[model samples]
Target: MSLTRKRKKELKRLRSGAEDLWTQQQEVLANANALAAEARKQAAYYTREEIAPRVRGGYDQYVRPAADTAKATAGRYVGQARERVVTDVIPAVGTAVGTALSVVDHARAARSAAFAGEFKKAGKELTKKTKAATQNSGPGAGSVIAIGLGIIAAVGLLYAVWQTFRADDELWVADEEPAAPASGTTQQ
Candidate 1:
């Protein structure tokens, strides 16, 4: 019904340990987020610098010559129009697509960073407010524990007093008739 001093001390130590573990978890989460952002940037850069050029080279080698042949088979005015689309429009579209992907990646990174900053700021503000409120509030943990202990002790004492003073006449049960006495024994 009551905690020993050692038990209470152990509980306090456990609470502090849990708080330390929580702090470590928060640090790990922040570090992981940073690493993810860096990885994203690296991937985007690799895509733009390495992969995009290779894709463009493939398109030029395989697709452009075919378009040129098709344009030659067509008449002069149609060929000129096809040449414009092949030379100008397709490359522009590819470049635009690459630029859009880059912009989207950058935007997502910026949004993530902004959200992280705001979340940290909110956490700091909340901690400050909680500390201030606790400083002004009544009945800290020790007081609460003491009150709980007092209630438990009161209940225990009341139970003991009740048991000590209460009658127990109805608690016993005897056989309806006594077993037959041994042959040499006399009945009272």
Candidate 2:
């Protein structure tokens, strides 16, 4: 055969295959769309009949009673809890309060004792200072008096010395007038 005729026949075969595939794709898409529509309708019908009633009946028959029971049980629990609190917790709290008060009293007593001890210590210190002061008082007074007397004595001695220096008597006066100068000394 010639090359042009052979090429033409191959091209015709490929075109027919492509057309067949395109028609099959169209058919598949149409079937898919139809199935999706049917599925939506069936879902709507099932929701209305089966799902709706079950949900409504569950709410009415089971869920409501369950909720009411839970509510009643919660109320009873709360009442019992309150009673337990009154019976047990209140006494526990009272005991705790009493214990706290006792501890406070103990602390107060300890503080009082500490304060008394401190007061006693201070009193002891005061007494010691008073005794020391009393013991040293006489010596201190005597020392001051002695110092005053010594100062007076020194002043008296100074006054006597000043008076002697100021007196008219010669400080080296002879008993006789040098024995009349030894009578001119020829009487040796």
Candidate 3:
């Protein structure tokens, strides 16, 4: 079989048409992809560098002054607190430590003196004081005095209350003398 020239020409024309359609589609898709990439880059740049800075101004305009003032006040307070620790607290701690050291030193001295038999004068003075205390306050004198005072106060308070509420015309008393018993008594 031999091919005809008219059919070959027609086949060529159909192939050219298909290739044209494909080429047009390729151009459109390439342009769309390029435009999309450019759009993405522009959006990222706007958000990161341009629009982001403007939008972030809200904090600087509205909140920064108050935050700065608060920070400065807090700094001043920290300085004052440090000063107080250095001046007042440190001195108080030092005084307490000094007092403790002095107390220990005094106790050691007193113990050494007592052991060396050099505290005779002090011992005699202490003995006299202890003897005087024992004589004046025998056994539990403060407690006894306190108890006696409490009882007297209670009786005085009772008497005052009774006198305040009692009738003026009547008196409550007891006889000091008692009648002697009879030697022998008989009753029917």
The order by descending lDDT is 1, 3, 2
lDDT at 6 for candidate 3? 96
What Cα-based lDDT does every candidate model obtain? 0.76, 0.75, 0.75
lDDT per residue (tens digit) for residues 1-188 in model 2: 55698899999999999999999999999999999999999999999999999999989998999999999999999999999888876675565455446556555655565577866655555555456456543544334545566799999999999997786666767676444444545654
Worst lDDT run of 10 residues, candidate 1, spans: 136-145
Candidate 3, residues 85-175: lDDT per residue as tens digits?
8877666556545544655655566567678887975465556545544663343433454556679999999999998998885475756
Winning candidate number (lDDT): 1
In candidate 2, which residue ranges exceed 4 Å CA deviation? 1-4, 118-188
User: In terms of TM-score, how similar is model 3 to the real structure?
Assistant: 0.43
Candidate 2 clash figure, as a count: 0
Displacement of the residue 34 alpha carbon in candidate 3, Å = 4.4
Please list all clashing residue pairs in model 3, or write none if there are none.
Answer: none
Q: What is the C-alpha local distance difference test score of candidate 2?
A: 0.75
Better of 1 and 2 by lDDT: 1
Candidate 2 root-mean-square deviation in Å = 46.9
